[model samples]
Target: MKLVIVDDEPLARDRLRRMVAEFPGYEVVAEAGNGDAAIRCVREQLADVILLDLHMPGLDGLQVARTLAELDVPPAVIFVTAHSEHALSAHNSHAAGYLLKPVRRDDLAAALARASRPSRAQVAALAGLDMADTPAYVSARTREGIERVAVGDILYFWADQKYTSVYHLSGELLIEQSLLALQQQLGSAFMRVHRKALVARRHIVGLRIDSRAGPLLSLRHCRCSIPVSRRRLAEVRALLEN
Candidate 1:
């Protein structure tokens, strides 16, 4: 797997680079001194996974994660931090896993193994959604490995130049596909609610007319309100009314 190491301390990056040498089939694609450099390296080098440090000068790990979340093909994040309190935040941010400072080779291997394994339920879930007639799985390449994800579990898909970002019930994953291709593969179960957004019909709970901003739709588990494009307002309303 193509991997990048991001840490403020040079020793930390060196240590991880040395330890990663023990793992077969894994190579250090790049190394960064801070979140900013890490983001640049991952984007330019197409890193599959990133071993990211939580604390740093300027942009921190969480900030890096948030920025990565916006990317079309985001690397699977494995946070390497000393603080346990940030564990909850890491999970909330949909990170693959975490490793403490002075990471053990065993722990790193285990995390990679978990990331590499296919979730059996993913296939079953796609079957249940009855989207087999269409291409419903997306290929997500992360720092640990590549994974196949069921599109049915995806809450929404957003276009990013040359790639698509998928937000699902369990977590977020990114794949290199145009929004047009994703919309085509997803078929009728998904609707293009806006020029850049496609939402799952199942995740749309209700539509609310925002007096100031016009119309909005509530997503099942997401707290933020999703805007209803003027052109799609009628369709969104009809979908909800039905």
Candidate 2:
């Protein structure tokens, strides 16, 4: 299993690293000095589990866990902290395990063995992290690193060959998800213009009947005209008319 360690203290990180080395079949993919770096590591490494600390200078461990819970496939989290008093809060975060500071090798081993993915219910309980009430953002890989683009800002999602591309006014990025997944996760905010495309209804300006393409969708803040499939033409038209 892949693992990511997040802690601000170099000594604590080193200790955890050494303990993790004692176990087999576990690869330490990356280490972060703070929650921000940990979030980046989680996205880049696709870690199976995260060894998170409860308190840090910028984003605390709970904040990090809350952020991770919002992800499509959030990794399991095990909080390694001295504040056992926050156990209930950690439990609410749906943490796989909570290991107190001055962690023993045996305790760490037990937590590792019982690691489990946080359920959607657990994520929903995280205050100010719920996106179900409104549109949320998704993380996409970029040249610099992973970036979170608001679902509202997304002009469309186009499946070009192997991967899906997310387009926005700022730029476009190739994401590791099927177009269908985007349509389903994004809910009614997007309309399926084609099997390979999902265009944001907010960005869609108008629909036009094209002699060659059959139906075309005009989107705001975008130069290229989108092709609306025959099966979805009526739906797209109705949405635009509304």
Candidate 3:
């Protein structure tokens, strides 16, 4: 696979290039110092993957990834950053991998091996296009790697401190996104049942009044009921009635 290395520091770029050379079946097609240059290089080389730096002077990695997503066939992005805080943003950008600075050879190889060209639907989703009135998928970082859950399969999202928990048909995972951000991206299909939770409108079968918890939402496939705030109780009832 063709790869593009984008980093402002020449030494950092060199280190990545050397590590990439150790691996077979992959070649460094181009190198860029900044986000704009990286975009130009990717377009010219038609790179299959990009080892993108998170912090840059101009567009920044997130902006560049969003721009690349607008292309007809966008390459997979693997964010290489010193900071771990941007993992959530990288996930939102549809990154193929997330690597920390001072990258290890094994991690780099693993990331490259997993990297593949993203589909048009994925590209649209990365570009933040509401083509289907909601994002195609929601991503979470796991011990293995990045895990993506289809929006249709999601039951609800519960906010737990810094991370938001995703409950889906298959199982539950954690994503680094605010509940408000998820609600906006998910659109009308998800309702903010409480300050800490967002429930899928389609999965909401009924609302039961709990003696202890007050009002709780019953989901189609979910075993546990989601707590509904008193403020949003009227709205939830209206939605169920309709």
Candidate 4:
């Protein structure tokens, strides 16, 4: 199978490349350090499988998987992660299989075996999106390189002229996609808290309405006070009340 591997760590990429070479049926077609490069690789070269890493500098594996879900011929996914907490989530995402970090040969083979099988339509249905809609995952190029961060991980999105900055629990990432396009694609989980910002409901810590400052929304672990537009204040209040 033609395969692509994406991870941020150089050692991890090298190790996986070596391991993939050892596998008889699988051939490493491309290797990328971030999700953006991985997407470009997959688009340029038809891949049967993608060995995706869960965490990276710019984009995480889940975002890449979500983006691929919108493709007509999405490659089978085998998620590689160090954390055990993500295992259930991967299963929930209907990943072909998952391998723990410092992957063993046997584990790689097992994941490949799972990938070779037919995919369930139920898994596709769970993505909850049509292809025409803006993808839930956006590819961004950062100083560290290209990353694929999931829309769900994003605490908020802010527009900066030609660029859109995505703020997540990890950090901020800049993407070329327009903020308006992102707002439309982001589901109800994200709301327009301000004209310049779109905030994720899950990340919202508290809402404070000031007669002077107007309505303020705070994101968890985030220090910045996000302004809520007059039109969106009622909606924010209603959401918080519920």
Tell me, by lDDT, which candidate is best. Answer: 3
Angstrom error of the Cα, residue 54, model 1: value is 0.5
Model 4 stretches with alpha carbons more than 4 Å out: 120-242
Please report the TM-score between candidate 4 and the true structure.
0.49
Clash statistics: count for each candidate: 3, 0, 0, 3
What's the CA RMSD for each of the models? Answer: 16.1, 14.9, 15.0, 15.8
Model 4, 1-242: lDDT tens digits are 78999888889989999988886767889988999898888888878789999887787899899988777768899999898899988888888989998899999988887685434332223234443453546678877788887554567888888888888756888887776677677555567877789887766778887889988898864778889898988888887787
* Residue pair clashes in candidate 3: none
Tens-digit lDDT track of model 3 for 39-132: 9999999888999999989889999999998887688899999988998998887688999988988898878866843443644444445566
Q: What is candidate 3's CA lDDT for residue 187?
A: 73
Q: What's model 3's TM-score?
A: 0.50
lDDT of 3: 0.87
Tens digits of per-residue lDDT for model 2, 17-69: 99999998688999999989999999999887999999899999999999997
In terms of lDDT, which candidate is stronger, 1 or 2?
A: 2
Q: By the TM-score metric, which is better: model 1 or model 3? A: 1
For all predicted structures, in order, the TM-scores are 0.51, 0.49, 0.50, 0.49
Q: What is the C-alpha lDDT of each candidate?
A: 0.78, 0.81, 0.87, 0.78
